[model samples]
Target: MTTSTERAGSGLDDGPLTIGGRDFESRLIVGTGKYPDNETMVEAIRASGSEMVTVAVRRVDLDRSSEEGILHHLDPDEFFLLANTAGCYTAEDAVRYARLARAAGFNEWIKLEVIGDEKTLLPDVQATLEAARILVDEGFKVMAYTNDDLVAALRLEDAGCVSVMPLASPIGSGLGLVNPYYIREIKDRLEVPVIVDAGVGTASDACATMEQGVDGVLMNTAIAAADEPVSMARAMRLGVQAGRLAYLAGRMPRREIAVPSSPVGGMLD
Candidate 1:
């Protein structure tokens, strides 16, 4: 229940991550999918220390009373539910799912995704932008998922999306930050929060992604597919905190030649 700062103490206290006017103590956001069972998923989520969790409207069992339903397992009062358009391939379909979640009285925040390809699982920039526009017009806090490109990120921010989510690699690839430069560029250029979503294979990936100075990271497969999901989840929480702290501390300038720690004029021998 404690935040990264609370657990790490004053030195690591970077403060809460704010998205769409809501402040979450944890900067790591996680997805609810790919676990063997709901119990494991809940335990893993709790371990990750994430306050906001994503749910694909198409996949959730809407009957809140059902034991197997995500709603039953993840208490809405405990975690902020972010509805997403996971499987939708078209702008209209993505919009439909977003609207469906809203009609069901779920939260208005959306993790908008219009998948362009089935094999690659890349997002369709055009469809994603179109869907974001519609969702924003409808008063939904849209968090668009797109490839790591500054132009697309800028467009999404201009389209009134609450946050811009750029993939570290193709969805579920676990490639672990293929293009950190692009993520940095997107973060440097955008006004809204930038969250690196997908392509994180392990704790190091989450750490590396945060080192780019992004606002946060969103991942699923990295934790869910791990052999020890609960343990991996805890590791990821620490990784995110470590990376953020390292970034804030700042790294020394990269140099081609090595510098002696002791004064060069003084000889120990």
Candidate 2:
């Protein structure tokens, strides 16, 4: 009798999430921000059961010896450290950051973000596409973070991105899955993995996002800002797995009218 805990991160259910020839058991990728402390961040990350932990490259110094840097606290052998161009506002800025980050990390994988506006924090898709092409040309595996637009997603993939990340909502809004149709449409249209990033508010949010049949979900504030981050991380783990499983199970069709269960033609008859 295998309990859910035993099977949670076992890689037995969801299988490996492959990005640019790298394999990951967990689909719940997380960020290294908004935690109260380094210890809490580490514990929450472990509890989340994510194989890859993404750090905002723009926010931290890549020098591993820097005690203040998040990399100093993380062991590369244990967790795959993914660098993201978090705050860069233009393709040039993101490309520069990506080059610097990869030089230090000795890896070409980068989560590219080129924010369009300070107020909404939505991505500048044009800049993101430009960065993706540049990074791809430089032999980097770019995972682009963009809005939920099918055309934009297709363009990113065409630009040679390894993965396309669509926001569930604005960053840190905790809005949950606001547009499942667009997400599903994007997933259906793209050959690359579609990871739903940002805007997941809770366990149910993560679950709902995954149930839309996207490859995975990446989140930060949802877990880090929780009153009990570790607990929330654990819940998010369950949520992601459950959602993936539910999607695999193939949900029953939706109906406009109620259908009775157990043959409702007078129970005694």
Candidate 3:
């Protein structure tokens, strides 16, 4: 029997996470928001061992006279910056943000989010798909943030999105996989990467999400809102790795009756 640690070390974890023809070693993608300070955010990101970081274009202070900015904290050479259209509520607004992100010298990689309601922050599927098509036609590698609707996910994929990110729950609700079956269904049908994007509360939530056989997870509030951000970041990193290893190793079947771990005939009567 191969131990989980041994299996993880034996090159079973060697496959790079490929999306939009880009490869990443780490499957956990962190976001640059809600952190108390830039230094703390940087530390948390480094501790998480995340290779990709998502930034909201609307939140950036483009008119700042100083050179210091979120971009300064995130080294482009070390991290793949994923510019997001977080505050955009319509297809046109999302497209405009994508253009602004491109003009900021970030590549055409976009995390497209078209929100419908301020209360729930749930994605507007129709608008999201519309923006995705527009962005894809303009040569952007779109990673769409959408609701956990399988049909909508397929539509986004058909619109040429590089990845389909279905929400586990409402944004920042910390609800944690309210409808996991839908996510699994989306993963089963999609050829592209399927990433769970929101409502992960902690390490276990992330672990559960990964064990669903999805490609990756993108989270912001979970780590930032933790009591100790850096420690939480480390926990998330380990949880993601452990969950991926467990998925690859294959879990033992659950039984309704008690089963002996050792040989049943070997015990004294």
Best by TM-score: 3
Cα RMSD (Å) between model 2 and the true structure?
A: 3.2
| TM-score per candidate | 0.92, 0.92, 0.93
lDDT of 2 at 200: 98
- Candidate 3 local lDDT, residue 36: 85
Looking at model 3, residue 196 earns an lDDT score of: 94
TM-score of 1: 0.92
lDDT of all the models against the reference? 0.91, 0.91, 0.90
RMSD of each: 3.4, 3.2, 2.3
For residues 5-88, could you state the per-residue lDDT of candidate 3 as single tens digits? Answer: 776664375588899999988989999899988888989999999999998775545787445567767788888899999989
lDDT of 1 by residue, 244-263 (tens): 88888787899999998878
Between the candidate structures 2 and 3, which one is better when assessed by TM-score? Answer: 3
